[model samples]
Target: MEDDALILDLQPLPDGIDERLAAQLTFIAEADRLKTVLRASPLAAADRRENDAEHSWHLALMVVLLAEYADAPIDVGHAVKLVVVHDLVEVYAGDSPVYDPQAVLDQQAREEAAADRLFSLLPADQAREIRELWDEFEAGATPEARFGKGIDRLQPMLLNWLAGGGTWSMPGATEARVRAREAGVVAASAALGDAAGLMVDEGVRRGWIRTSEG
Candidate 1:
């Protein structure tokens, strides 16, 4: 009995748990569950439509390549991470049109609710980290957030241009409207503005956006 007790005591226990990692994994798993509803915007390429996930991925790519254009110096990694998580609320809020003043008005409320519900599902610490990042992006108060916003506006402008001004040709879309939508990039980074200018030029050349109607 004494020998048996000593042997049992000598056996090692499993390692202590990493609650942080567990929470992170939980969030990552649930992240795929987000749904992105379209707002009458068509895709640039295939007949198939773009979803929120695709949009997030595209923006992440842009974040990497466009870091040099940020209005202020920023952590490119954080900027990319911000973009990856930004529209994740859209998975819940659905894609509200930038041109729809009413929809835009309601977007903040919807997205905040979605963030609460979605982030709460993760482990507590991970939830806090992710939610903080999401909040920073919404606030647009930091350099990373600004750059993220820039990419966010730039992507759709490019997509619409490629789609032959799918939204631009819609009843109320005008150059002024498009510029307003694209101008958020300036707040985030000047490079984003440069990119938007290039996109606007392309839109004009492709006849997707009107040029001289000012």
Candidate 2:
């Protein structure tokens, strides 16, 4: 409880701040526009450009509505917090295509740096809490992370299927793309798999998606 004792125990960020890091604070405000500017994942509706903040709102809403489908019991409140803050980094890092191979490879570096910078803007304790939640979401280790990821995968799959396979019909969409985008959720929850399968089936039945050629 003493000041000197606290200083002895306290640690600094794993990666210290720099000029590039400092600019991230101003960019964090752009997260408020995500819903309006960024589209859902490419598997979903490509026509819409949902901004970053809106995407977070939708993810939090999904966490609330779909908590029962989680593979294990979860603190939905914690899951909501994770989802709400997960992409706030995008306010600085910018959204990348989920299926873009090169983009996917580069994503972690870009986002990790963004996370370090954006979360540091808050008061020390609050910054740590938000950064830790963001890390938990990224690690995908806990029940909450798995459940949060399940919804994350499910939403775009559902949206794409509903939108008549908006991006799925593009020339390069392969079974591999579908698998890559949706498989993590399948691994996380059976109910999510079932829901995603139903969406895919509906997309085909409605002539929105073509079955793969032999």
Candidate 3:
């Protein structure tokens, strides 16, 4: 028989405590690196480049504020989630300027590998959820994904316009190319697309972006 006065030496932790907590904490810590991943787009009034984390935050806010502009009914919460997690892989894959032709060549493969490594840092369920969100945004199949993609394209274009054609000054940045790339914005939101078109025309007039024939 066991002694009534016997005391337990060490207490056992609750079930799944260490494994779950460790995975979550590790993922959170890894996500912090996104703050250092600088993008090609500059801040509206500032000279410094924007980081991926800041870009994601801005997109999340845009999702909330601009959901009404989406062409179809959408789940705003789901859209916000998609934008916030969409660029986490950029932390590992690094940013390629929108007009960089060489960089765009293998961009998908590079980002896919980055997504695998970054999302796998989380617990299995969480990893699967985030990877799926990232995939949806890439596919742009759903109304929400299309809206998210439009917002993503519009933000940098707006920033370039506001910065007085910051990156648009690149030689490859032609009015035709800009319009071609931003067609998705029109597909998702006509009003926003029209606004974007005006900005591009203004950039061309200002000689910030070159004319197609130039």
**Candidate 3 colliding pairs:** none
Point to the candidate with the largest lDDT.
Answer: 3
Compose the digit string of candidate 2's lDDT tens values, residues 88-186: 777557787664556567788989988886676566777788899999999999999988887887777766765667666655455556766567787
Model 1 lDDT per residue over 137-160, tens place: 988899889888878888877778
| Poorest stretch of ten by lDDT in candidate 3 | 1-10
Error of 3 at 11 (Å): 26
Ranking by TM-score: 3, 1, 2
Report the error of model 2 at residue 97, Å: 1.1
TM-score of 3: 0.89
Task: Please state every model's RMSD to the true fold in angstroms.
Answer: 10.6, 9.6, 9.5
* Predicted model with the maximum TM-score: 3
**TM-score of predicted structure 1:** 0.78
Total clashes, candidate 1?
2
